[model samples]
Target: MEEIRKIIHIDMDAFFASVEQLDRPELRNKPIAVGGDGDRGVVAAASYEARKFGVRSAMSSKIAKKRCPQLIFVRGRHDRYKEVSKQIMNIFHEFTDLVEPLSIDEAFLDVTHNKKNLPSATLIAKEIKKRIKEVTGLTASAGISVNKFLAKIASDVNKPDGLFAIPPKDVEAFIEDLQIDKFYGVGKVTADKMHKLGIFKGKDLKKKSLLELSRLFGKHGAYYYNISRGIDERSVNPNRIRKSVGTEHTYQSDLIDTKEIKKDIQKTTQSLVRRLEKSDFKGRTITLKLKYSNFEQETRSRTLLQIIQGEEMIQKLAEDLLDQEELKTSIRLIGLTISNRINESEPMQLTIDF
Candidate 1:
């Protein structure tokens, strides 16, 4: 029999907001948000207090303010956050090198054979959370399970300085009771679709045959089928490569005129170029995405013979893509992504707050 892997998923609690509160005593216990407060500003992170008023990350600053009139907006200090993230990652390294960082604030650790040789992954998770609080004055939640899928879900169960463990025996039952939306890959839209198919929870999902699911959800149906049965074969990978780099923006108002749209595309391309320069990533495929005022979305892609790195080429390609599509409505969002990397052998490993 194969040995059950000991996987632990650790997620920081309101990471950016917590970090800001840690450094700034005045912001403690107050409804604070980390991001711009301007008309087009977006919430990068929100404190627990801000969340009470329905303020959330990625929400527009205008809406966030309306939700929480007293919400305090602080500029994001990404450098500080990254510095803290490094410290947290170093702590994870001390216990095990099988650490897979999902984001700056969260990671997955395979401690089935830890350097500490501690027999219990639960104890290791406790130690990690304790050390993070001591070093960064922040709290982290942990979920210990047999695989990455269950471990990630367990981490969010209690949240904010909490920890939960699912032993091999309880994995099936726990998953059966889990809500459909709680599954890793099921987003809001997907969950609604699943509900329509009478798959409101894991148990309901399990009733469907693999073929049935595949026929409904395409390729992702297999994943849903396996996970519903508490089976995820994916192993923790430490060296994950990023496959693409891109940037996008939501305009403060819908853009209708072609000249204005082209100008914004230029600015968006410039931003994407900056990101590409920062990450030093090169790709041959350029995809242009647009979401109209009515929320309808479309994407157009072109694969070039050579890698696209220069802003002139990217902007031209993006403009060409936009020109090719008919504008049925005004555009509210524009995104430019460069994927299919020059080196296609390795895949980038990267994800969410919870």
Candidate 2:
């Protein structure tokens, strides 16, 4: 026998832009975006007004403006956002300790057993939403369901200041009518593959057997099979930790010179070093990412016997990764990330048990 879980995913609406609007009274009811107002930078968030003009997060600021000439851009204040995040997270703690933050703006909370001893998760969601608005003057949309997958998707079903819940009884029908693109873990690339396989909706996805899905999707086949039927078993874990630390730069313009590229690598390495120092995280694997002029992306990584430390080793490996590959076109972006972090204090685990 198994127990059903009560999960709620809370996502702030256009967090960065909303913060901007909240702090600046004059900006309300106006189109605004938050990010670099430059040719190469990407939009981090778009106001509801900006969205009407087809502006969106991750769209280049240049194009975002082209979509809406009046789109006002503001630089992001991460510190201020983090401060507000702390306030809301405090509110979440008032309900349940099993709160797992997905990002700065989204989180999953397991309130099947909460501090308030609430009998209803929907009521809890409503209370949380009201409390957040009263405390931070920002709006958050919430989705309540039996599990993380459904709850996460449900959060987006409604827009800003919205609440949606999928009860156990309604889960199946709700999932069946859901479109394929709305399924968890399906992005543009995976959606294209699914569309080609004639899976345009949840019902279509359910038609495929696990064996067929596995053959097509490899390791994630079982995930799709389960999620398609409104089945997900992931628990809300509050103690999740970061696996990697990275920094990236979408260049102001494409870089054609190897010398200039190396300089950029050194600059990125310097920044990474500071972050690594701040977190005291050392990773054995260094991954280098590049985006060519055509927006084709490539990533290459190297693992070393020794944990990577200091700016010198970081720069050396970054340069080595670049040397291993020949640029097919002018590079538009570059990034450096490190993983395989060494947990010096954690005891080693046995490979087998008798």
Candidate 3:
């Protein structure tokens, strides 16, 4: 018999916003956002107080302000965030070396073979949470289960300084009652498609055969089929390298003028550059994405001979990519991505469903 893998997922509560609040005591208990406040600005993170007003990450500053008139905007300090992340990750290592970071504020840790020789994953999760609060003065939520999929979902059950665990004996019943939308990979689009096909929840999804789901959702159908039955075989990998760092913005109004489009491109490129510098990522390929007002999307990519890191160089490349094609219609969105990283030659890792 295959032994169940004891996995734990840890996620900080509104990490960026929480950090801002932690550093600035005056911002505590107040609705705050960490991102730009200008017209082109997007919310990088929103406090729980802000979230009560339906504010969310990636929402336009304009809409977020409209939603929460009293929302406070603060610029993100990625350097500080990174420093805190390092502290949290080091704590995870004290318990186990099998820590796989999903982002700066969340990670998966496999404790089936932990260094501490602990028998209970739940106890470990609680201890970790306590340690994080003690060390960073911040709260984190933890989910522990038989595998990464279940663990990730369990973590969100009791969020904002909470811990939840799904044991092996209760896995089947627990999964059967889980909603399809709550499943690891089921996004809004996939959920709607599943609903149309009468697959609204795990029980509904479990009725479909592999062949049937494959025909409907392509390769992802197989994943949905297995996860619906409490099956996920992903292992925690500590050395997984990030594939790319990028950012995009959607305009409230369509941009028709070339000058306006170029300006937006420059702004987007600058944001991407900041992200690259924060992550210390270097890549040779620069890709520009454009979404037309009618929702038609196009991409242009260029690969340089050497690693590219400068803001001026990246902005120029993004603009050049924009000039390559004439606009057929007004553009509603613009994005820039840097990939084809230099010297990082590991095969792509499995997706950890957010």
Please give the CA lDDT of all the candidate structures: 0.88, 0.88, 0.88
What 10-residue stretch in candidate 2 is worst by lDDT?
Answer: 344-353
Residue pairs with colliding backbones in model 1 are 241-348, 242-348
Which residue runs does candidate 1 get wrong by more than 4 Å? 245-286, 289-320, 324-354
For residues 1-354, what per-residue lDDT tens digits would candidate 2 score against the true structure?
677789999999988899999999999999999877866466778999999999987677889999999999998777788788889999999999999987777899999999999999999999999999999999999999999999999999888789999999999999889998988788766888899989999999999999999999989999999998888888899998779999887776799798999988876886676456434577789999999999899999998767898767899999999999689899988999999988968754445547
- Number of clashes in every candidate structure? 2, 0, 0
Which prediction has more favorable TM-score, 2 or 3? Answer: 3
What lDDT score goes with residue 83 in model 1? 91
Candidate 1: tens digits of C-alpha lDDT, residues 1-354: 988899999999999899999999999999999877988566778999999999987677899999999999998776788799999999999999999887778899999999999999999999999999999999999999999999999999997789999999999899999999999978776888899888888999999999999999889989998999998988889998768887777887899898999988876876676466434477889999999999898989998766887767998999899899578889988999999887636553432348
Off by over 4 Å in 3: 245-282, 288-299, 304-337, 342-354
Error of 1 at 7 (Å): 0.2
lDDT comparing candidate 2 with the true structure: 0.88
Model 1 accuracy (lDDT, Cα): 0.88
